[model samples]
Target: MDKERLYDELRIFKDRHFLQQKLKSPLTVYVLLALSYLLITILFAVALSRVSVLSSQLNEMRKELKRNHSSEDFKLFPCGPEAREWEYFSGKCYYFSLRMTSWQRAKVLCEEKHSHLAIVNSHAKQNFIMYRTRDKRFWIGLSDQNAEGVWKWIDGSDSTTGFTYWKEGEPNDSNQNEDCAHVWTYGEWNDVHCTYECYYICEKPAPL
Candidate 1:
């Protein structure tokens, strides 16, 4: 009887289980969205921080480059061995002839040296050449050899467009054959007969 009572006490009368609660609607989505948003925010902050660092480094490099090259001549002419026997200005090399010759002969001489007559394109170049001229007349490479009154450089650049330093009542093509351009004593320009003997200027490309 005691054994039967012990068995009855140890036996379970009904099946038993702990209940599990289901997550509520919308709460699951809210939690997932919060996690996703946090992950994306962290990634964006990392990318932005890296970009800022790179930008700062590039700016510093640019400043250093400018500082290093600051003393260098901004003129593209390298003024080195390859540009020997020439003077540099802006980005071109100029050669002033000590001898006087006809405009056509001057052009021939310049072409022989693999260059053309000086083509002044800027006020600075005009001033520089004038200072070197010392009040003497010099021939440039401008002409209307192709068409009357339609002036052009020997290199075929249109001269009607920019920075002309013509003298008063000049380039009148005085004899209807005045086609070549020359600089006067005070840096003014005039068109004269190609046969006129005058000092010439030559120009060529600067080095690489």
Candidate 2:
């Protein structure tokens, strides 16, 4: 009878220990799951923060790049001597008139613009003017209006001592009325009537 009682008590104690161990296991597992969730949330928040910082940095870099590009462009192309409708080349600024007018009117217009008619004194200047004039008959600064058979530049320089590209058999005083010299398409000079309408070129020294 005593032995039976002892065995019963031992079994009861064992069962109680096992139930306690099972309850403790479930609580530990729940704690572990909560810790894992907290860790994942922290990691996600850190990743989002990093992404936002990177985006802000990238935007700032783009703005800085644009500013630098604009500054460099300004440095490369500063204010030149040429104004609107003028082209700068070889220490001079030239204006090619789009409309045709009489040689005297063209000269006046150039003077009004603070310039003068084109005074080509070298082969290089003539070629440059011709290239721009193209096929158009553009009036230059050469003429014998002062004295027939005595050609002179607008600046009063003698034409014979400078440069002259007269076309073959040009300045022949055709009809006794051709006194003004104009450039032909082939970079040659021709004597045309001063009243004849033609495109013209203006020249001025480039500001230092």
Candidate 3:
């Protein structure tokens, strides 16, 4: 434990074979580390690019699948030749036929089947019916039978602002006797006495 002996031991420890092993050059080690880091960055960038491209392709494929499936679904429920046809877009069923009955009778028939006569709303819907019927005449729900000249749909909908595809000057109560409305050829509308029978169209909300 003398100072001279302690210094001699320290020197011996520093000069040992293990401690004398050649050390790595700091500059060379740093250069190798930098090169490895750059390689890793490049690899990561390539991997990210590939992943992005794959993700985009997957998204596009999903969209195409949805489009195809939706079209197929629509085709499964087509408008058939039944007295009532379903309108998928509106979730409603429509009946466009020529059965000629009084407005009250038509309403009663519709109610019995859990529906009411057709209520023409938009021009688009009227045109849609016309096209489906091949421009044939059908009765709508509108009528002024209660108080002549005050037309209203079965649902109490005011047809004043509604698109009236009426035949020109036809609802003039021609004989001052017309009390019912009916769709005519060319998608035009006309008024007739309720007693005069004509084909009618009925509409109902689709059952849930």
Candidate 4:
């Protein structure tokens, strides 16, 4: 009876040791898996941060490139003798001298000088020219003489849609006989008789 009792106690000890060993192995495996997951998560976060920084830099570079291209695209005209004393800006040249001439005569003169009538594209530009002229009236390159009341610019642009600075009650064909457009003392546009004389503005494409 004593031998049997000792044998049963030994078996019980062996079973308990086996269970402890099995539990230790599975616990170690779980710890290793958790550590691997933490490492992967850290690496993914770092990669995403780097990608975000690079994207922001790329966008800034694109905007800079666009600004440079815009500046490079415009070419200044009448660069040499014609506007020798005048300052050039944004591909256009200005002459501040108040030289008055008839519309047809002005057209002929500008053509001889390798230019055409000036076409104002913006209010700022128009104001700049108007201010420079010392409030004197000048002739722009728009006329309706051939068509009688249908005005067109020297560059073939339609004046009807582009007229932004018309003088009050202007282009009224005041005498019911005005067929030419001219700038006024107040930096506005008005219709005048074709035979009337006025100072003129001229334009030409910039040299390549």
TM-score of each candidate structure, all chains considered together: 0.60, 0.62, 0.57, 0.57
Report how far off residue 3 is in candidate 1 (Å): 99
lDDT of 3 by residue, 84-110 (tens): 255533667776555667777887887
Best by lDDT: 2
lDDT of each: 0.84, 0.86, 0.75, 0.74
Task: State the lDDT of candidate 4 residue by residue for 1-208, as single tens digits.
Answer: 9999999999999999987887689777798788889999999999999999999999999999976654554333245543565446556665533577788888887787677777876887787777766567788888787677678887777777874677887777869778777778767888887668888877665543
Deviation from native of the Cα of residue 91 in model 2, angstroms: 0.4
Query: What TM-score, to 2 decimals, does candidate 4 have?
Result: 0.57
All candidates: CA RMSD in angstroms? Answer: 11.0, 13.1, 11.5, 13.1
Best by TM-score: 2
Question: What's the candidate order when arranged by decreasing lDDT?
Answer: 2, 1, 3, 4
Query: Residue 136, candidate 3: how far off, in angstroms?
Result: 3.2
Angstrom error at residue 145, model 1: 1.3
Across 59-82, the per-residue lDDT of candidate 2 in tens digits comes to 999999987876665344332423
What tens digits encode model 1's per-residue C-alpha lDDT throughout 1-208? 9999877765633212211122344677688789999999999999999999999999999998985564353343355444556778877888899899999999999999888999998999999999988778899999998999999998899998988998999779878899998998698899999999999999987654
lDDT of residue 117 for candidate 4: 70
Worst 10 residues of 3 by lDDT: 77-86
Residue 77, model 2, lDDT: 33
Off by over 4 Å in 2: 1-82
